[model samples]
Target: MSAVHEVAPVVDAAHAEPYATRDEYAGAIGRIRSAAEAYYAGADLVMDDAAYDALLARVAATESAQPGWAASDSPTTTVAAGIAGGDVEHSTPMLSLDNVFDGDELASWAARLERVLGRPANGYTVEPKIDGMAVAARYVDGRLSQVATRGDGRAGEDVTVNARLVAGLPAELARPVTVEVRGEVFMTDADFERANELRTGHGGTAFANPRSAAAGTLRAQDRAYDAPLSFFAYAVHDLPGGEGLFHSAAMAAIADLGVATTAGPMAAITEPGVTATTTPTAATTDPEATTTSSPPAGMPLCATIDDVLAAIESLGAARGSLGFDIDGAVVKADDPADRDRAGFSSRAPRWAVAYKFPADTRTSRLVGIEVQVGRTGVITPVAVLEPVQVGGVVVTSATLHNFDDLVRRDVRVGDAVFVRRAGDVIPEITGALLDARPDGATAFMPPQVCPRCGGEIDRSQKRWRCVRGRACGAEESLAYFAARDSMDIEGLGDKVIAGLVRAGLVTDPADLYDLDAESLAQLERLGRTSAAKLVATIQGSKTQPLSRVLTGLGVRMTGRSMSRRLARHFGTMPALQAATVDDLQRVDGVGPERAATIAAELAELAPVIAKLTARGLTMSEPELPTRPAAPGSAEALEAPRLPLQREDGSPMTVVVTGSVPGLSRTEGNEAVERLGGKSSGSVSKRTDLVVVGDGAGSKATKAEELGIPCMPAEEFATLLAQLTAVRLG
Candidate 1:
C-alpha cells in the first residue's frame, strides 16, 4: 500500500485566508457543503465554482493547521461533500481527484507519486477535465444496461432512461463484452443552444450554463422535451479477458469497441522510441468528428512529467476554441502497474490529479451599494464596484439580483469582493473577500420604501416591489418614451419629465398625450415657445409607426425586435390586446412566461391604451413584403426574388452597430426589418451580417472576429434606399 501522506499546506493566491478561527472554518465548511448539495442536486448554485473552491481550500488549510478542530462531518472528509446520494453500488469506488492549481503544485504532486512508487513514474496521460456530470455506464454483453451518477463515490443514482438518449453513448457496443464505461455527460455548444431553444419554447427559463443544463436534463424524468446530451468515456473497467492492461491501451480498446473517449486512442509504448508532439491532433477523436468517417486519432502520450505539463499548457491554450467547456486537465499515471502501486485514498485515487485552471474571476472592491427600480417596480440592489477586469470586460457595476441575495451573500461596501463574469458574459459579485475587508465595513440595508417615489414596499417575495408599480417610476418611463430611439419627442428630457411627474400632470405614458402647450408651460423651466415646440413634437409622435409606439410603451419582455414582431404579426393594437397567451406565444422568442407577462401588462395598461386611442395615434403596423407562392407552383417560378432575403427565402439576421447617417439605432434596426431582414441586437456566430458605422466597438470587433459579412453604413444606406424603392414599386 502507498504510504498515506498529508498534502503540503500551500494556499493558492485566490485562497489567502487561513480561516484563523474555528468559527471561520465551520462557516466555510457550511457554505461549501451547501454549494455541493445544490450542485449535485442540479439546482441553481448559490456560489460560483471559484468561490466554492476557495472556501474549500480555506477549510483544508484550517483543518491542517489545527488538527483536532476538524469536525467528523466536515466536507474535507466526504466524497462530493457527502451530499449526493444514490442506491446503485458502483463496481469500484468512483473517486474524486485532488486538485493542483499551478505547475509547482502539479510537480509536487508528481514528486509524491514518484516517492510512493520508489522510482520515477512510468508516464502520464492528460485529458480535458470536462465541466460535466460524471457517470458510470454498465454494459452487459456489449449492450448498454444501466447508468448511474457518481454520487458519493461508492454508490450513485440510476438514470438509465436518460442515459439511453445521450449522444456518444451507444446503446450497443461493437463487441458484446461485459464492461463498465465511466464518462462525463455534458452539452456541446450547439447542444446548449438547442437545449435553450427547446426549454424557452416550452415556457421554461433558459439554463445559465451548459454544465448545469446537462446535469438537469440528465436527471429529469418529467421533462416535456429532451435537451441534447453528450458523453465521453474516460475509463473502462470489468472488461472480460482484459486484466493488467495499460490504462492507455484500455482506453484505445474501449474506443475500438465504439465508446467515446475524450483522450482519443493512446498507443501503449512499451519501447523507448515514442516521442510527444506539441500540436493538437487529439480533437480528431471528438465524437462529433467520428460522424465524418475520420479514422480514430491518438492523443499525446507523454514520456515524462515535463511532457505532461506541456500537454496541459497546450490544452489550456486551445480551450476557447474547443466548442466545449473544460475546467482543467486531468493528468494520470498511464501504467496500470503504477496506478495499482499508488492505490487509493479514502476519497480519491492517488494515481491521478486535476490541474485546475484559474477561474475567469477577479477581485474588486465594493465602493458603494445602490438600488434601482425596474419598470415592473421590482427593487434590485446593484453593486457599484471599483473597476475590475473579468473575462475580458471591465465591470464597474453588478446587480445583486435582489435584496435577499444581497443579505444572503453578506457583502458590504468597502469590502474587497470576488467578481466573475457569470456565464463568461455577465459581471457578477459571488461574495466578499472577507480577508481584504475594512474594519468598519457593515451590511447594507434594503430600502423600506421605494427609492424613486417613496411609496410603500411590497416585501412578500425575495424581489421587493413598490406598491405603486409602474407609477412609481413614471419619470423613467416618460424619459424612455420620449428618447430618440422610441417616440423621438424632442426637448423632453429627464428633468422635464421629473418636473411633470412631480406636478402630477403625468402618472403614466398615456397622460403625456393629455398635456397642451398651456399646461406644459406651467412646468419649472419651460417657456411658451419651448412648451409649444415640445407639444408639437409630442403630437407629431402620433404619426410614428406602431413599432415605435410599442417601444415607447415599454412592454416588459418586448424589445425593438420583439415589438416589431408583435406589431407585424398582430397588425393592430386592438389585435395585440385581444391576443390570448397561446396566440402571443406564436411570436418569435415569446415563450409562455414572456407571453403571460406581456398579456398581463397589456391588461393592466388597458386604460392607458384607451387614452392613447382617444388621442388618435397610429395603431396599425405596415404589411411585410408579400411571400412568394409555394415552391414548384406556377407563380413560384415567375416570382421576383425578395431583396435582403436568402435564396431560400428566409430573412437574414442583421446587426446594426454605432451610428448610421441620418438614422437612430432604433431606425437602423427598423430599416433592416423593412428591407426584409431580421435585426438582432448583438453579434454572434449565427449572425449573417453586420452594418458597421463610425464608433462601432465590441459588436463590430466581434463581427470581424466571427467573419460575419459586413457592410459600411454608407453602403447600407444606399442598399436601404434601393430596397425601399423596390418595395414601393
Candidate 2:
C-alpha cells in the first residue's frame, strides 16, 4: 500500500462549542457520508468544508469523552474524502490507468511488468481518456436488454430505461448477436444550448458541461424529461461469445451495430516492442547510428522506441480529419502474445504509455464583472479581464459562470486568473492560484442598476436583471427586436445607431419609423446617402409579419425559442399579445415561470403595439420561421430565419452614452463588427441606434434629450434584429 495521505486541520469552530457526547459524534459522521455522496456524484454540495470539519471535531470530542464508542468505522476514525468526485460506468470495469510523470517512472513500471511475465513484450494499445460520462450497455441475442452506469467498479446504477432512449442505441440487432458496449452520453452544441435555454426559462439550474449533464441525466430518477440528450457508444464486448471482442474488434462491432463508436484510433497504430540485447553495443563504433534509419514514406512512422515518436507526429496531422477530439497518442505493443511477456504492475500495464502536447495557458487579471441583460431577462454575468495573450489571441474577458461560482471560488477584482479558450474558442476562467494572490483584493457585488437603462434590478435564481426588460435596456432590446425572427430591420448599422444616440435622434423602436435625412446629416459621420438608406430601411420594416413583431418586443423569459412556440400557437401578434398566463401554460413547453414572464411582458407592451398598429405597421404571421409542415399544413421546420443579426459574425449598430458594459469605445465598435454589423456614433433618424455599457455621461440624457432611442448594453440583440432587415436596396 502507498503512504497514508497527510491531513492537516485548518479551522476549529466546534472545539470552542459544547456537546461532547457519543450520539452527537454519530450524527456528524452521518452528515459527512451524505455530503460526500452528493459531491462525488456531481451533485450540489449541501454543506461547506468548514462545517464538515467542525462535525469531525465534534465527533473527536465525543470519542475522547467516551472512547469505547469510537469503533473502527466511526466518523472520527475514517479519513475525510476531500471534495472532488462520480461517473456512470464502463461496459466492463473501467479501471483507472496508472500514471507516470517522468520517463524514469515509466521505465520502472515497465521493468516491473517484465519481471512478472519473465520476457520481453511486443504489442499494446494506447488511447486518450475522454473526459466524459461513462456507461455500459449489454445486448442480449442482438437486442439491447440492459444498461448500467459505473458506480464503484463492482456495481452501478441500472439506467437501461434512459440508455435505450438515446437514438444511437439500436432497439434490435442487425445481426443475431449479444453485445456489451461502453461509451459516453453527450449533448451536442445545439442540444446543450436548447436545454440551457429551457432551463433558464423554467427557473432551473443548468449543468456545467456536456459531461456533467450526461452524467447527471443518466442518474436521473425521471429519465423521460431529458431524453433529448445524445449518446455515442465506443467500446464493445461482442465477439465469438466474447472471444473476438478485444479492443480493435470491439470498435468495429460497435460500428456494425449502428452505434457511432469512436473512429480513427484503430487505424495507423504502431505498438512498441521491447527486446533485451545480449550485450551493450560498443560506443566507439557509434552503435546508435547503426540501429537507426529514416522513416518509411511521406511521413515518419516507427514501431520501436527507436521510431515511435515519428509515427505519433504523422498520426497527429491526420486527427483533425478523423472526426474526433484527440489530445495525445497512446503507444502499446502490437503482439498480444508478446505483451504477456511484459506483464503488469498493481497500478499500470507495462506495454503502454501516453505522450501529450503542451497545453495553451494565459495570464489575466480579473478586472470587473459586467452584467448583460439578454432577451429572456436572464442576465449573464461576464467577467471583464485585462487583455492577455492566449493561443496567440488577445482575450480581454472570460465567463465567471454564475453568482454561486463567484462566491465559491472567491474570485475578486485584481486577482490573477488563468483563462482557457476551449475547443470552440469559447473563453472561460478555469481556475485560479491563490498562492499568487496580491494584496488589496475585494469581492464584487453585482450592480443594482440596469447598467443600460438606469432602472431597478430584480434578482431571481441568483441572477439580476432590469425589471423593464428591453423597455429600459436599449441596445439589447433593440437587437432582440431586429432579430431575423423579429422585426427583420435589415439596413440599420450599429454605427448608425451609435451616431443617432451621440447626435441625439433615434429613441425606441418606434423612433426607427420616424427618421429623416436633414436631422441625420447633423450627426458625426452621416452624409446624404447613409441617411437616405437608413430612412428607407426604417420605412420598409413597417410591413414585417406578426410573428416577427411579437418577437421584437424583447419580452422577458422569451427568445427565438419561446417566440416560435408562441407564434406557432397563436398564429398572430394580437392573439399572442392577448395570451394569458393560463393560456400560455397550455403550450407544450411553456412552464409556469415562462408563462408568467410572457404574459407580463406582452401586457406591458400593449400600448406600444397599439401605437405601431395604428401607424399601419404590417403585422401578420411571416412564414419565414415555421416549424414543419404537418400532415395537412405547409410550414418550414422551425424555419431558419435570416437573423437580423448574429453575435458571432457582425457587430450590432448602436450608440452609447451614460454607463455601458465595460467594453471600451473602440472595442465596443469591434464587438459589433464581428457580429456582422457596425456602430453609429450619434442618434438620428438616419442613424441606426445607441448603446450605453457603463458610465454613460451627458450623451445618454442628450439622446433622451433628442427623443432618440437610447439603448443600454443588453438591448443590442433586439436592435440588430431590425437592422438585419434594414438594407439599402
For candidate 2, write residues 1-729 as lDDT tens digits. Answer: 000001123235324243466666566677766655553364433443334545555666666777777756554333223222234444445432343323454456556655666754443344443334556778788777887765544356787776665645566656667777676655543444455555544555554343444556666775335524554554556454445334445555556665544342222211111111111111111100111111111212233442444344433433322222233455555454544455554323456654432222345678787876664445666889888654336788887656655655566777666565433344666444454456877777766677766777776655566687554556555665665556766656576666665555655677667678777767767788877876787778888656557667766555443455566567777877777889998764565666786787678777777778876786665442323334223332233323323323222345655443545454455345423343444443233456665677655654554455656676654544454455322
TM-score of each: 0.59, 0.43
lDDT of 1 at 721: 82
What clash pairs does model 1 have?
A: none
lDDT of 1 by residue, 273-379 (tens): 11211111222211101111111222457877877876776566555445566777888898899999999887778999988875644566788999998766878
Candidate 1 stretches greater than 4 Å from native: 1-138, 141-359, 363-369, 384-387, 403-418, 423-426, 431-448, 459-462, 627-641, 657-659, 681-685, 694-708, 726-729
Candidate 2 accuracy as lDDT = 0.52
